[model samples]
Target: MSLPSTFDPSRALSLARETLDIEAQAVAAMALRLDQRFVAALELVLKSRGRVVVMGMGKSGHIGRKIAATLASTGTPAMFVHPAEASHGDLGMITADDVVLGISNSGESEELTAILPLIKRMGVPLLAITGRGDSTLGRHADVVLDASVEKEACPHNLAPTASTTAQLAMGDALAVALLDARGFKADDFARSHPGGSLGRKLLTHVSDVMRSGDAVPRVPREAGLMDLMREISAKGLGMSAIVDADNRVLGIFTDGDLRRLIERTGSSADLRALSARDVMHPNPRTVRAEALAVEAAGLMEASRITSVLVVDELGRLSGALNSNDLMRAKVI
Candidate 1:
């Protein structure tokens, strides 16, 4: 890396701070400006039978794409249609049932203005987020959200900086309000984003990751210590459930238990003589298979245990899972 001879670090830092201050003030001003118009916009979108069709040009076009995505993920059906594309055959994408949200910093993008009349003619309600309510886009809009910023963060006031920030803030406000009105929840968001970490945590259940049947380590109550140890080693769960003939869990034996037993009895104790019933801890913590994997994770953390046994409604041993299972499933 290298710096030019004219580079001044302090000047760069001062300008960066000023830019943030300007953008922050713009967003704050917008909040104070909200009124019945914003509410009307929300009602319009909520009442629509079709999607919210977002349209913009250039920098606004980029912001529109993001707003559309946010609305879609948060339970509102929305999509972005570039104004220039709408001028072409893409105008057909807008239906009478849809609500059109046009975004422009100056409210005077040539491509956007050219399509306003066409959108109005389609009988779709128009909503505008722009700096000038007197501008052509605003005049055609049924609801106008005043996103006007006093100035751009750029020193020359030529870049889209602060104005774009205000536009983004407006988009976020709409998405959040609409989500609340529609009763959209974290689970709904998770369904739209199944590949994300939050989706895995909310959607994965204990039954999906637990080891069951022959994969679960278990031994009869009368099993000797050697038999219990073999079951643990073979299943690789580091624990074995002591069950009755009917498969009801009687107790649990783990590596932690074995260590504690060794500490109490010392090396002189005859380990080979002990049976599963003699070594197991009774009334172990267990979770149902249908419970969320995160719940099992919570139980393990709260109890300071590494694994938990899964049981059916009748309290029979059904499965087993440990920290490793949660880790592999990315639920931890």
Candidate 2:
């Protein structure tokens, strides 16, 4: 068969568009079919004391892994198991306290159906996500989630395109439902994803990255101009807090203030007369040590300041943090 040399690219684009439209319609149909079985499935998994054991074959198995990941990340504690490997002893991973989620488009995948009886015998609640409600796996399931699609997006009508997308979306629905049921908070997510930027924003506290003790770049209110500059250089926070004898912050001396002071004073003698109280910016921005790093970043941005003094509940200076610290913590 010779293909037409003058074939338009628009024809191929139209076909692709039609395929997606059909898939979207299929998913919409599935949503309309949702019933009490969905609720029962969620209850079964939510009541399980152990993990959600997800099992499937081929493309369904790939979708199962993603579903399991979403469940685990949202506090459901799920893990995917390949049905092909289950007969070889991986079935030991499932326990009576667990709920088994089996995904099979036809609901009759030989590998998946073969273990249905075993999962039943173990007293594990089996939830099947399938197109055919009368399939062997569905018949054995305690609850069935209808992930049926009218047809595949493949041109030949044989690939797992629309069905897989529906399954993925349904799996997300389950994960999100479970997340809401468990009251999963962003802090809980941060604990699980400590390496990501979201983790830094949620888990990082001001105390974790704040400059403390001698590194806070603090000086007494009576400190001389030269002494304040030395403290700023040694601390490298670009600002020094002027504190009282009790270590309570009274004012702040920043590099910006130093520049303005230099411009106003024509000579070293004029600059020498400037004490901490005389030149310091009084009532500078401050934050609590227990505040979020992101909050610190906000305070810096709103005040147009580079550094903030970290104070305790009693208003005594405890530490300091600059934009650099926020950058290092990935909070900015």
Candidate 3:
């Protein structure tokens, strides 16, 4: 689409700034009006044994869907149901245990108000988010939340601009209140979003990403430096763990250790004569397989190392992982 010949860059920028200012003020005004009514809405939703049935019309419906998603992700059971569809048999989705949350700018949206009586007859509590507390929807509501705005940000005062913003803010306010009331935590949020990065950081364990069994680089304490280097190179973990006959972790030797060893002994020294026990750093950083992968990353970062040895509760060498493994798993 081409811009109109009369389109003024300064005018467009001014309108954009004014729209944001109007929306910001609308939300701020709603915040000031919050009182016992807002509390009633929160308590109503919290006490319900069923989900929150959100309903709206037109632009409000679009906001309702987003609100429902936010509520569901934040530990609240909620879903959006189009108000217009309610009259078309979609009303069956609402249970008696559920709470009906209606959104409208005028509080008399035809599609939304038409079902207010049905919702009430079903013995379900109604929560209204609207501009007019005296309007039909608010009159039928068990709890009314005022989402009023002085005017629309639209130049003609016709579009649902600030009004819709207020409705969205009210929905977010309810979700956040209910989330805190239920003691929702970051881990709970991550569980709902398992495919997200937060889930990888919180749910992934060391055992889930670490190389185990023969794949782990390990050399007995009596092993020669040549064998130790071979294990490190073969495992490609940039390190090798030194263990005893019982496979209990004794120490770890990494590329850094090898570099410092060579630098200290000089090229003329007999590097072949060094044993695993003589070159390895004793009691190297180790993490339990059951621990979170993020915890292993923290250990490596704090110790200034690239890799860490995984150990069992008995301190036996079980697996190994490096920064690369964490990056692959997206836990770092």
Tens-place lDDT digits, model 1, residues 1-332? 78898899999999999999999999999999999999999999999999999999999999999999999999999999989988889999889999999999899999999999988888899999999999999999999999999999999999999999999999999999999999998889989999989899889999999999899999999999989999999999989999999999999999888889999999898999999999999999999999989999999999999999999999999999999999999998
Name the weakest run of 10 consecutive residues (lDDT summed) in model 2: 265-274
Q: What does candidate 3's lDDT look like per residue over 1-332, in tens digits?
A: 99899999999999999999999988988899899998888889988999999999999999999999999999999999998888999999999999998988898899898888899999999998889999999899999999999999999999999999998988998889999999999789889989989888988999999999899999999999999999888988889999999999999999988889889989899989989999988988899999999999999899888999999989999999999999999997
Choose the strongest candidate by lDDT. 1
The best-first sequence of candidates by TM-score reads 1, 3, 2
- In the range 210-252, model 2's lDDT, one tens digit per residue, is 9887778888999998898998999887889999999988999
Best by TM-score: 1
Clashes of 2: 0
lDDT of each: 0.96, 0.90, 0.92
| List of clashing residue pairs for candidate 3 | none
TM-score of each candidate? Answer: 0.92, 0.87, 0.90
| Model 2: lDDT of residue 36 | 91
